[model samples]
Target: MYLQHFALTQLPFSLTPNTAFYVGLAPHQQAFEVLQTALAAGEGFIKISGEVGTGKTLLCRKLLHTAPAHWRLAYLPDPALSPMELRWALAAELGLQYSGNIDQQQLHQLLQRHLLLLAARELQVILVIDEAQALPDETLEALRLLTNLETEQRKLLQVVLFAQPELDLRLAKHQFRQLRQRISFSYRLRPMTVAEVAAYVQTRLSIAGNPQLRFSPFALNRLASGSRGIPRLVNVLAHKAMMLAYGRGQQQISWWHVRAAAKDTEDVQAEPAFIWLSAALMVVVIFGMLFWQWGPL
Candidate 1:
């Protein structure tokens, strides 16, 4: 509804993990580089871990989108499969045709033969699993066994796991030692910084065709602080702030709009009773800083 008011052609802050709106912030960029390098080096297993809403899914999609031509990618967005189901899913992703009543051993043979065929054709097969933290223990072990399907030169299937931080805790157990050992490279995504959050908002706005629609310094600072520099929270606050501005028929987002948005959002970590008073004080402080930074904004 606010798209026309904000001169935006698309929703800039939608929660979906769309690669077109991906921001190459420091953490995401470094993680991408690490994944590319590790995959290029023919590592059998790699992992990218982040807190929820830290863009792991977005980065995973970006990696899949830019994967090398020699690599065939199989994506598993849900990891709640049993060992047998996991095998079937992998077989399906690899386009292996098999009977519905196929036994586990038969399914495994079919998958291994398909992988061998791909390897013979000089193509590397990659399985990228998202939400890997939810994978059952036996399923994870099955994945490790998949990596063991290698020739003398290179692995038949490389796996890149994109999961939340809980995946690391799961891997710390003695039961997962073999799977953990196979992870040749790993990257942890960090939350964005305050400045990075500001730039992120601007970048998305530019992508949505409205670079001129600006968030005031005070509002942006409140957004950055309340969101704790997390991209998803920032998006939520920004979208709500813009809606407030649209309601008031205002062109630029202000501190009051951000304060109201933060007060309404459960993720903003604001004390319910102190929102208005804190906003008043923060406005004074923010204006003072703004004046000092820009010589009377």
Candidate 2:
């Protein structure tokens, strides 16, 4: 609704993880480098863990797009499958079609054959699993076994797990010792800093074809504090603040817009100290304007 008012071609703060709007924040960039280096080394298991809204999916998409030509990527966005289901999913990714009446043993044989064929062709098959915390214990073991199809040089199937921190806790258990031992590279994603948050907002706006609309320093501070530098919350608050500014016919976003936005967002925590200080400053400004105009208390 504010596209024309703000001179933007697209909405900048959408929650969907779009690579076009990606800003290589320090943590994401570091994670990207680690993934690339690990994959190049033919690591059997690699893990990337972060909190809920720290841009894991975006980084996954970035890796997919930038992977080398010889790389074959199979992405599993949902991981709540049983062991048999996991095999079937991997088989489908490998383009191995069979009758529904085939038994689990037969399916596994076919899948292994296909992976061997791909390895012969010099194709590096990478299975990237998002939301990996939901993977069951049996399914995790099945995935590990698939990586056991290696020749003397490198693994036939490599796995990159993009998950929340809960996945780390799961892997720390005794049942997951094998999978943990196979992990050659792991990274923990960090939240953005205040400066990174500001840069993130501007980057999105610029991608959406920003012309003149801008956020005030007060608004940026409130957003960074309220969102705690989380990218998803920053996007939610920023979108709401832009809507408020447009509704008020204002050219710039101020602390009032951000304050109202934070109150509306469920996950955002209000920062009361700065809120009271801003209120006091507003009152002093109002009093000064009144005294200059009509003289008096």
Worst 10 residues of 1 by lDDT: 267-276
**TM-score, candidate number 2:** 0.92
Steric clashes per prediction: 0, 0
Give the per-residue lDDT of model 2 (tens digit) for 1-297. 999999899999999999999998899999999999999999999999999999999999999888888998888999999999998888888787788899989988888788889889999999999999999989999999888988899898999999999999999999999889999999999888889988888889999998456788879988999998899999999999999999999879898999999998898876868668998999999999999999997
Best by TM-score: 2
lDDT of 1 by residue, 1-297 (tens): 999998999999999989999999899999999999998899999999998889999999999898778989899999899999999888888888899998999888889899999999999899999999999988899889988999999999999999999999999999999888999999999988878988999999999999998999888888888888888889999999999999999999998999999989986767345767897999999999999999965
Against the true structure, candidate 2 has what lDDT? 0.91
Off by over 4 Å in 1: 271-297
Q: Name the 10 consecutive residues with the lowest summed lDDT in model 2.
A: 210-219
Candidate 1 pairs with clashing backbones: none
lDDT of each: 0.91, 0.91
